[model samples]
Structures are given as structure tokens and as C-alpha cells.
Target: MQRDAARLLYGNAVAGIMISLLTSSFLVFAFSYPRVDPLKKMWWFGMFILLLFRFIDVIWWKIKLQNTEFDGKKSITHFVIGANITAIMWSIYLVYCTNQVNDVQLTTTIIAIAATAGGSATVLAAHKYTAMFYPCILLVPGSIGLLLSEEKSLHLLGILGLSFAFVMLLISRKSANFTVHTLFLKNENSVLIDSMEEKVKQRTQKIYELSNLDPLTRLYNRTAFLEQLKRVTTKSEKQFALLFIDLDGFKKINDSIGHKAGDDILRETANRLNQFTSNTQLVCRWGGDEFLVVFAETDEKRAVEKSNKLISLLSEPHTTENSILSVGATIGIALYPNHAKTEDRLIQLADMAMYYQKKQMRSAVCVFNEEMEELFAYDLHLKNGLTKAIENKELRLVFQPIISSQTLKVAAFEALLRWQLKGKDIPPDEFISIAEQYGLIHEIGAWVLNQACLEVKNWNTEQEVIVCVNVSVIQLQDDNFISIVESALSENLIPPELLHIEITESVFASDLVVITDQIKSLQAMGIQVSIDDFGTGYSSLSAMQDLAVNMVKIDRSFVNKIDSNGKAIISAVMHMSEALNFTVIAEGVETQEQSQALLNLGVHYFQGYHYSRPLEIKNIPAYLEENQNNT
Candidate 1:
């Protein structure tokens, strides 16, 4: 920057010197024409010597300016000295040339002073003092020479010249000031343009970062992860693997506690994932409750080992403001060039493996395979069809009678869901698991409760027959599940005692406060609570103690055995049931021996194929009528 300024100064000064010298030479010759005075000659000669010396000094300075221009202090010092010398020399020339004060001589001196002073406006105006002094020096001496006039006309001309010199000085000051103002604005405008350019670059970079990052977890978003997958897959030699991680039971946690808890879980999960992942660039937030990771130049064995480590770490509890939350993860792995050549296909296979593993482990890590992929395709079809199954009348209720062992009569009927798609019956295990896996249980379970209540209302037996409908852990976690239950009872004009809700022990495996509160709410509405599939889940007796349960239904696994051990387990369960003052219903009494074994253990109620297979809603009327007369 300094170099450029110095260059401009050098060029302008040289040009001004040459122009001033040429114009003044013509004026000097014309004024000194005919015979010159001796005193005037000597004065002119002395002034010429000074002027010549100053001009040569400026020429030397200009030549050296090329080398010393960038030294800011030296360049400014040289310019100032050269400018001051020129001012002094011009003042001397004016004084000496106008000593006689002849009309022609006075005119010539005035013309020379004007021309010389005007040149400084362009060259030295940017330096305020230099421009101001140039005109002052030229005019001050000339006006003084005129002031010493003896003639009246000469005295008047002297006064006029003095006034004119004063006016010209004012003009020079303004020109210098205007030049300073122009320099200031040019500098400011250049700075402003540079600042705007920098700001634009910063904003553009920030926008790019936001587009590719997930706001909550601070991980890569779906779009960026896909781009990464494409980049990795394009390499033919280097192998990489894609991992899809899904947080299991996250929806239940979100619905039960709140979304804030879910968010905490997600952030903590991302942190944990980042710790296990050596490469930060490989982790991504694959939308809600799922993440995508890449292992560049990693083999399938190492991928599986890392996935297991991830699972173990994820299973550790995360403490939030309200609760200690812990959830499992399901990871699906697919290798590059091994699973598929294309990026989309690799991601698809990994995603399929993730869902497949989640279904089998109900949450764990597994690698992609042709079998798992094919099963996932079928499961995908089932999941998509399961949502619409209830609406399409593809699903219906089938009542399995639970009969009293001593009376040999129907005590209550458990409503089981049956799915028949396109004249082909889809097993409960297939469709129900699909529903639970994808959080459709809330929708499906509510429908079951509503349909059962309405169907039982149609029976109108007046015998206070109970209609038991199974509730899922997901359904129990739903905030609106209790409302749906109450609505079903009230809307159907059935007393809550005539309806029973059966929840498996898995529901107790969730938040105890939330689960117990829901069960208490159900019991408060006069609805009977039963822990179904007992002995098959974690515990049988202790959860019943927490719950306001009216009955405990033994899981079919325990009853179908009929071994001494099964009887012993049933005996302990019966004793516990009596102590708790709740009825015990033995499920899966498919043979006389299983029923007899249950009865000998002091169990009264039984349900299985031996008594009656699950009857469809339409066929229940005929069975109820036949049994109604007999009972």
C-alpha cells in the first residue's frame, strides 16, 4: 500500500516540475525583452540560481523515490523537503522579477506566479501544508513588492494585487482540503468493499455447515451421510462397511416420560457412538431414533466387533432430569462391494438387516445376509399391510374361553386378534410382532379394546361375562391409552367390571411408576387387570404385588409341561395367588393331563384347545347360546 502511494507521489511531482519550468521560461523571456536594468539583472540572476538548484534537487529526489518509496517515513520526508524548497524558490522568483514594477514585468511575474502555484494544486494538494504554502509564497512577496510603490496608480495596483493574492490563497487552501477529502473517501470505500467480501465468505461457509449437520445431535444428517456413502463406495480397492443403528424402545420412552427425555437419550447415544467410533466423520444421525456409521477400510469381522461394543455401551443407563433411562440398540451391517456395488443398494441392505436384527433380537446387532434381506422384504410387506389391516376388516377378534376347572363352565373369554389377508391367515406372532416393532400397537390395541367392548355388549348375557383384551407395553405407555379404555367402556354401555385388560409382565419391565399408575387407573375404573403370559416373562409374583390385579394368567409354556416341576411351580404360584387374593387362570391346558395337573395344584380356571379353540366373533354367539343353556 505504501509503495503505491509513493509511486503516485513521485510521478506527479516530476510532471509538475517539467510543466512549471516550461511555462515560466516563456514568461521570463517575454518580460525581459528589450534592455534590462542592472539591478533587475542581478536579482533575476540570483533567483535563477536558486530556482535551478531547487529543480535539480527535485530531479535527484524523484530518481531515488523508486528505491526509497516503500520506506514510509523516508518517502514522506523527501517529498516534504522537496515541496518546501520549490515554495521558497518560487517566492524568490516573484520578488526579484517584479522589483521594477513595469506593466509588462508585473504582468509577466503575475502570470508566472499563477502558473507555478496552480501546478502545486495537483501535485501537492493531498499534503495540505505544501499546497497552502505554494500559493502563499508566490503571492506574499509579489504583493510586498507592489506595496513599496511611490506613484498613486502603482499604489492602487499594489492594493489590488494584495487582495487578489489573498483570494488565490483561499482557493489553494480549498483545493488542498478537497483533495484530502477525496483520499479519505477512497480509502474508506476500499476498506468497506474488502470487509463485505470477507463477511460473504463467512456466511457462505456457515450455511454449508448447517445444511449438512443435524441440529440436535450435531452429527451428519441423512443427506450428508448418503453423500459420504457414495464417496466411499466409488473406491474400487478400498473396502468400507455401512452400519445402521436404531435405538430400541425409544418411542415408548418418548411417549411415557416426554420428548425431552427422548432427546436426552438421543444426544447421549450420539456421544457414546462418537466415543466408540475412532473417526468422527463416519457417524451420522439417520433421522429419529436411528444413526448411520461408516468404517472406512474396515472388514466385516471388525465391524461386527465394534457393533457389539456399541450395543454394550448403549445398554448402559442414561440419567435425565426426571428418570434414569436405558434403551437397547439394533445395528445392521453391510460391506462395500461385498453386499452391493451401488451406494443406494448398500444402504438399503444395511437398513433391511437392521430391521431384521431388531425383530429377531427385538434389539441387537447383526450383519446383512441374503436370508435376512429376504425375510426383511417379507416383514416390510407385513409391516405396511399391518397398519391398514384393521381398517380393511382383514383383522378380527377370536375369543378363547377360560373355563372354571371345578364348574366346567365359561368364566371369561380372552379376545385374540386374527389377521386374514387375501384369504390367507397371517399368524398373530407375525402381524402382532410387526405392529409392536413399528409402534403401531397403540393404534391396534385401542381398536381391539373398542371392538371387544362392543362385541361383549352384543352378547348381553346379563351374567356379568368378562371380555379380556391383551394390551401391549407400547399401548400402556401411550398417554391416551387410558382414555381409549374408558371411552370403550362408557361408549358401549358396559360396566367396567364386565371388561378385563390383560397386560404381560413385559409391561412391568418399563417405568414402574408409569406402568403402576396405568394399571391403577384401569382398576379405578372398575376394570379387572390380569398379568398375562406369566412365568414366560421376567417374574410372575412380584409384579402382581405392585399391580392392582384381579387375576394372574399362567403362560402356556408352564402349563403344557405337566411335569412335577411344572406342578411345583404352579403350586407356588397358586399359594401366592391365594395370599394376594387374586384368581389364577392356567393357560394352554391343551390336554387332560395338563388340566388335571393344574387342578391338583389347586388351580381352578383353565384355557386352552382342550376346552375350545379360539372362536371367531361370529361363531361366539352359537357357542355362547349352547353353553348358556347348559350352564
Candidate 2:
């Protein structure tokens, strides 16, 4: 738009200059040829006017020069040459009209010679080779005719020279028009290229922003988080705290309210977290329902205080159509130079602390301490041990009898994983938590499934005993977990219905869209899924209704004190299971009284030391035989 306006203004200025020059030239020509024939005078005046119009073209050329944006030295040279050509034509027309040359008279000859010489000089200076060459040719012959004689042949030769000069001028004017058009095209192309370059720069910036930002919440993602973490860690004079926060019970909200509402809740939660933290703090979305906050130059106390404030802010009720959802957060903090020297280790320590905090019933923040470091070191050692366990054949599966209270007979065996490091045995709780922390549970879970299926394949009993294996939340997160289970069953020639996977409530405490799909996939393959450690860890009745689960294993926390606080809890869980048509398994029955109490509450499936402790694979055969003989 601006370019067009410039061109118009330049064209108008050139037209005005041409009009002024043409008017002045005609007045000179009329005054000088007052006694000449009227027709001849008019013809001369008309030619003068045409020459003035060509001079006015100088204004148009000037306007073009003003509008044309030149990029380099070459364009400036071309513009100067075009301007000099217009100036030469104007000079020649002015001299000719003022002199009023008549073909029959020799008095105007000198003026003609001077005008041609001047025009030739201008053309040579402007580097218009074609215009200069023809003018020089006409000038030599006309000068020869003036010097030779006042004869009729000289007049004829002079006429011939003028006619040839006029034809050359017409050709030069045409060439000038072509040059103007070429310059216009070149300028248009340059403008287009500039516009494209600007657009490319904007797109590049947008791509860079998208790469670092989370699409949903518009916060920095894990990639950007690590970059900032490195910057903070490299500065030796600065101290900071990294807080690893995980949303508590976010899975239940997603399962009950739907994913759309869950996304809204996540966005709102991010905004609230940002609001609670100061501008100096950096908050990033650390994948899924996890967030990382970097508090600069802060100690554990201030970090925990800020984390608690964020938690409190998030705990406010978010009103939705399905329900008024309230959420809590567990934060783990690791201080710089105190926790670890590297950014990766510090983040790991913070995550470990956060997991430990979430395990506590009432704690919202856990600071990295010596004990946590020891735990992480131990876990690191155990992870290395676990990786080699399969190669060394150090892992063994033992079956604990699940006794039916009504029949007083073993109905199924829950497969328990045990690992022996050298001569020492590792407890399932210790290594299992480590496995979950290191995301190695999926591989370990697959190994357990294969071992259990292999064992069941060799059993010679006619009675079908279900083999239950516990699965961690991390195990179910794998997309191929169900396929792995099916492959194991097929390889061992065991029926899918004979294998049951027991997942704790914590497994369901994640995005149920994934968990539900996994459960349905397993159930579709004819495998039973049960929620172990029920009545604990964010369990909701709606989850049981929506998930494809067959049983609920009541946690021992309620079973241990059934005579007092446990009775009401046991009754509620049993009743809820019964109402939902789910089989209830009472766990941690250590005494005969506890077993009898569970029986009175109509609990059937029993698994604890009351029957047998988690036995080694060697002792399992004898235990089963002994129990069978007694029955």
C-alpha cells in the first residue's frame, strides 16, 4: 500500500514538471518564428510541446526514483542513467525550439550543431551506447554538409540526417519504457522477498515457543524445566530448592468426572499454583499430574512453606457438573548443594521425597534428609541387583494359600515375588517400592507372571486353583502389559481365567482412561482383576463400579483391630463388596480370633500368617500338602 502511494505521488510530480517545460519551450519557438508559415509554426510548436512532454517524463522518472527502494549499488546506477537520458532529451528540445531551425536557412546550422553535440555528450556520460552512437553519426554528416557548400545536395543531406536522428530518438524512447517496466518488476520482487522473510522469522519464533511450552496448561514442559534446572545448578553462589509435587487423588476425579473436566481442573490447578508462588519462583509442568517448582535462594523451611501454601490453594473445591471436586497435593523438596551436586540427582531426590510424603497419612511436604538419601542409595543398589536377578535366577515365586472361610479349604494361591541378594532375602515391600520408584515394576511384573504361569502349568491337581499376582501402577502404565500377560499364559499352556491380577487402590489413583482401558483389555482376555489393599489409599466406590474388577482385598489395617475400630471398617467394606457383587478377601489375619472375627463378618477369602506366612518355593509344596491332609 505504501509503495503504491509513493509511485502515484512521484508520477504526479513528473507530469507537472513536463507541463512547465513544454509551455516554456512553445513560447520560445512562437516568438522566434513569428514570420514563418502558420502551419509550419504550429508544427514546430507541436514538436516543442512533444519534447516538453518528454521532459515532463523527467518528473515521472523522479517519482519512480523516490518510490523505488534500492537494495544495493547496482540499482542506484541504473536510476542515474535513466535520469540523465531524460535530461538530455529535454536539453535538445529546448535548444531546437529556441533556435527555430528552417531547412532552407544556414543561420540556424550552428545552433543545431551545438544542440546535437550537447545531447551526444550527455548520452556518452549516461552510458546510453545506442543513443550516443546514432546522434554522433547524424552530427558528423550534418557538420560535413554545412562545411562543404550551400548547394541543394547539402540541404537534402541535412534533411536525411534529421529524419534518421528522429527515428533513433523514437527507438531510444521505446528502450527507456522497457527499462522502466523492468525496474518496476525488480522492485516488486524485492518487496515480496522481504515480506516472506518477515513471515519466516515469525513462524520460527512460534515453533520455538511451542517446543518449550505445554500445549494444555501453557506452562513450561519437562524439557524447559531441565534447562532451567541446569542453569540454577551451575551457579555455585546461588542456593535453591526444587519442589516435586504430585496431585493426590487426581485419578478419581478423572475417572468420575471425565477427561474434559480433568483437563479444566489441571489448567485451573496450574494457574492456582502460579498464583501462590512468587515471581522469583519457576513452575513447570513435569509430565502428567506432576509439577516442578524451583524456589531460588531458599531453604527447606521456606520451600516447604511455599509448597504448603500451594497445596492449600489447590485444595479448594472446583465446582463441576458431576461433583464439587476437591484435590490435595504432596510436595517433596530437595535443597541445592545439600541434596546433590547435579540437577538430575536433585530432581530424583525431590521425587523420592515427594513419594515418601504421599505415603504418610497426614504429611503434605517432605524434605530430603539423610534417611531419604540412604533410601535412594539403597534403591539404586537394589535396582542394579534387580536388573541381574533374571540372569542369575535369583528371583523366586512362592504361593500363599487363599483359604475359603466357608469350606475351610484352599481355593487359590496368591503368587508372591521374593528376591535373594547373595544369601540375604529382600522383603517384597522394600524392593517393590524401589521397583515402583525406578519404573522397573513393569519388567519385574512380567517376570512374575511368567514364573507363576510356568508353575501352574506343572501342577497335577484336578481342582482349578486361581493364581493371583499383584500388579503395580507402573506395570499397568505399559501399553503392552496385557499382551505380555497373554503371551506368558499361552507359552505356559495355562488358561487366562486361572490367572488373576491383584492391583492395589493406588493403581486406580491415576488417570482411569488408561487404567480402565488396560483393565478392560485384561478382562476381555478372560483374566480376573481384583483391587488389593482395599479401604485404603484413595479408594472410591465409583471406581469399583466403573472398573472391570472381580474382587476387593480388604486391607489388614482394618482387619488387625476388628474387635474395636476394625469392626465398623470391616463391616462397611464387606457390605460394600457384597452390594457390588465383588468377592472380598480379608488380609493380615494373624490370629485364630482374627480369622473367626472375619468369618463372622461373612468374609471368605483369607490370606495371612494365620494360615501361613509368605513361604519360600521349597516350603510351598509341603505347606499345601499338609493343609490338604488336614482338610
Candidate 3:
């Protein structure tokens, strides 16, 4: 809008100056003429007024040009040259109009020629196509009239000059219109380009944010965390801590509650973790229920303290729509430049430590140590051996008889796992721990459950002797474990009452609310659930009552030292089980003293090396037959 107005004012000034120059040239011609009449003087005065008006218009255009924002010196120079040419043209016109000359006829001819020459000169000086045509159309004809008719030349010059002036005015008008249209188009294009750039910038920013964030929890995802880990590790020489936390009982939560509720819990858990760490640490959703925390400039003690704080924070009751639930986390800490030199190694070491801690304590934090490296190496070796065990048929299920203490007869056999590496027996404790550590327990547990079910099907017993299999914490945590158990039962065509699933105290320690619900679901199918190594864990009396368990096996630690520390513990366990209406089984009985002590404590079942060691499926039939005949 502003640009169009400036162009209009400039064009008008050019037209006005052209009129003034023509009036001035006519006045010069009138002065050379001898006939100085009243009419001629009036004509001169009229030319003066036109020149004055032209000068006033020029001043007005100069003010407008001063106000206008010139793009460059080129536009300013163009306007100046056009204005100067128009001024010169107006002066020549005024000199011719005055009609004052020494020789009237000669002066009129000279003035006419001079006006034509001056107009041509003005057009050349202006260097404009529109101004060039004006001289040829108006000035050339007026100059030819001076050579021909004396009376008609002045009138002819006036008429022709006005026509040229109008032509110049029209050209200037068109130029102004074209200038306004061009500026409008350029401005619109500029705005469109700016808008596109802004949109691109916004989209790029959104993509960057999405790439770094976890979709489920809105926390920093694994990729982003690892990149940050690399940066922090590289810049700082000070030791930092990397904590790998895995939620205990998350699978049970998923199974008992729907996946939606489980996801809600996970998101809530992420929020809690973020709040707990705040700005002092970097908390990342490290896939599933696991999280990784990178603590800068922190040592082993501070890291452990932080882990404990986090554990304590998580242990608080979490409110869901269904119930008030409590969840626990097992944290594994690995120190920078101490436990590992690189970021990948550090994360791996931390994960290993966390799993080891989960296996040992089940719900406690553990730091990586040199001893852990040895244990990890041993576990790795066992994992390799176990992987090959299936191919070699070296992985075997051994049955240890759980005999009735009063009847002194076999009641049921607990299926224990044994691995033989090249005909040499590996202890159940050694390889079982390895299997759990390496996440191979699911496969091993399935093998044992299947073998035990098959063996139970083949057994010949008048009494309904049940086969119990110890399910690892890892196995219980598996979503497929229940399906595997159901399939095994169906494959063997054994009644659900004949099979019992034995879970250790540690399994209950993890996500107990979920574990109990899962156990109840299993119980609904008529399969028995027993707490193995019961007295060793921190199971509350209320929890024991709430859990739909059929039996509670007294831990060997309590059974072995029944006369000493075990006596009181075993007595308490038996009484507690009796009070809860749960059957009691005493494990690890090797001596008459231990046996007598448990019997006195009202232990109904006994399992030990004294009765029979865990045996192969082939050996179990003859042993059970012999024991039945002996009884």
C-alpha cells in the first residue's frame, strides 16, 4: 500500500514538471517576438503559473520520495533523471509561449526549432521510452507549424504539447500500476516461504522429541539413555554408578490384572522413579519393567544408598483402581572405570549384577564385585553345558521321595533337576542356580515338569501318590509357564490332583499379590501349590494364610539344625502350618535325631538323603515298588 502511493506521487510530479518545462520554453520564444500585446502577457503569466505549480509539485514529490523507503540507489537515480528531464521540457515550453522576440517571424521560427531541439534533448536525457515518444509526437509537429503558418503555430504547439503531456501521463500511470503489482507478488511469495520454513522447523523438533522418548512411560528410552551414558562417561574422569533395576512380579501383575492395568502401573512406576531421581540422576525405561539410572560422580556407597532409597520408595503401597499394591525392585550397580571401562560393558555388568541379586536376595540391591565376575563366568559355563545337555540327553529329572513320617512309606516324590556333564553328576544347587541366572530355567523347568508327569503316569501305586516339581522363581515369572504346565499335564493325561507345583519362598517375595493371584488361578484348575524352603523367607503370617498353598516345606537350614537353631524354627513353622491348616513337610533330613525332632514337631512328611537321593525315571519305579512292598 505504501509503495503504490509513493509511485503515484512520483509519476504525478514527473507530469507536472513536463508541463512547467514546456511553459518556460514558450516564454523564451515570446520574449524573442516583437508583438508584446495584453493577450501575450496573459499567456506569459499563465506559463509562469504552470511553472510555479510544477515547482510546487516537484517539492511535494521530493518530500514524498524522502519519506519513501528506497530499495537501492538505482530507484533514486531513475526518479532524479526523469524529474530533471521534465523540468527542462517545461522551461522550453514557457519560453516559446511568452512570444517576445527582436525579429518576430525569425524569432518565432528559431523558438520553434529550439523548442523541438530542447524537447528532444530532454527525452534523450530522461532515457525513458514514454518520454522519447512524446517529443516525436508533439514537439516535431509544432516545430514544422512554425516554418509554415505564423498565426496557427502557437495554437498548434499548445495543442500538440498538451497531447504529448497526456500520453506521458498515461505511460507514468501504467508504470505505477505495474510497480504496485510486482511488489505485492514479491511480498506474498516471501510470506509463503517463511511459513513453510516455520512448519519444517516445528516438524523437525517434534521428530527429535519422539526419537528420544519412550512411548509407554514417556521416559528416556534405551537408545537415548545409552547415548547420554557415552557422553557422560567420556567427559568425566570421576566414577559414576549405573544401576539396572528389574521389577519383581511384573509378569504376575500382567497376568492377574489386565495388560492395561499393568501398563498403567508401569507408567506410574516410571513417574515415581523420575521423581525419586529428580535432576541428580538420569532415569531411563530400559525395556519392559526394567529401568536404568546413571548417577554422575557417585561411588559404590552412594550408589548403594541411592539403590536402597529407590527400593524403599518403590516398596510403598501403590494405589490402583482394583487394589492397593506393593511392588519391589532389584537393583544392580556397576561403577565406572572400576567395574567396567566402556559404556556397553558397564550396562551389561550392571544387568548381570541385578539378575544375580534378584536370584540371591530376590528383591534386594547388589553391587558388582570381583566375586560376581567369577560367579558369572561359572554361570556362563553352566549355561553352555545346559544348552548342550538337551542335545546330549544329559539333562535328567531325579525324584526324591517325600515319605509320610508316621507310615514310614512313600507318599510322593519331589522331582529335582540334575545335570551330568560327560557322566559326572553336577549338583542340583550348582546347575539350578546357573539355569535361573541365565534365564534357561524356563526350559529346564519345563523339562522337569514334563519328565515328572510322564514318570507319574508310568508308576504303579495303589495309593494316590502325587508328583511334585520345584518351579524356579524365573519359571513362575514366565507368562508361558502355566501354559507349559497345562500342556504337560494334558500330554501325560494325568489328573490335576496328582501334580503339584512347588515354588520357593523367594518366588512369593516377588510381586506376591500377583503371584498369589496366579497361584489361586492354578489352584482353580485343581493343581496344588506348595511353598518350598518356607521358613527361610520373610513371608508374613497373613500372606501365608492368603496364599492358596497346599503345603509348606520346612527349609533344610531349619531342618538340619533342628536340635540347635533349627528346633525352635521348625517347631514354629509346623505349628504355624497346623494353625493355617496347611500340610507340613520337613526337607533335608539325614539323621534319626533330625527325623525324630521333626516328627515330634508334628511334621507329616519327610524328604532327605536318608530315605533316597533324587533318582532317574527308570530307577524310580523299582524304588517305589520296593518301598511300597517294604511298608
| lDDT scores of the candidates, listed in order | 0.78, 0.73, 0.74
**Model 3: runs farther than 4 Å from truth?**
1-169, 210-213, 216-285, 289-341, 356-369, 422-424, 460-464, 473-483, 510-526, 561-580, 616-622
How many backbone clashes does every candidate have? 0, 4, 41
lDDT of 2 by residue, 1-631 (tens): 3333334323433443454345444444544545644644555465556555545544545655554662334433443344444444434443343334464343344344445444433233223353445354535445445435455545555555566566656655555445456556777898898999989989987897798889888788888878877887786657788889898878677766778878888898888877877545778888888888888888878888877887888889888766788878888999988878788998898998987777664338899888977876787889889888888999889888899998777788999898899989999888888778667787888999999999877766657778999888778878888889988999999999999999889865676778898998998999988998887767887877888488889998998889898899888888887778888899898999999989999996899988888766667667667777888
Query: Which predicted model would earn the best lDDT?
Result: 1
Tens digits of per-residue lDDT for model 3, 13-93: 555455545644554454443455454555556656656655665575577555667543444345545544544443444
User: What's the alpha carbon RMSD for model 3?
Assistant: 8.6
Best by TM-score: 1
Clashing pairs in 1: none
- Estimate, for each residue in 197-251, the C-alpha lDDT of model 1 and write its tens digit: 8898889877877988899998888888778777767755588888988888797
Q: Model 2 scores what on Cα lDDT?
A: 0.73
TM agreement with the true structure for every prediction = 0.74, 0.62, 0.66
Better of 2 and 3 by lDDT: 3
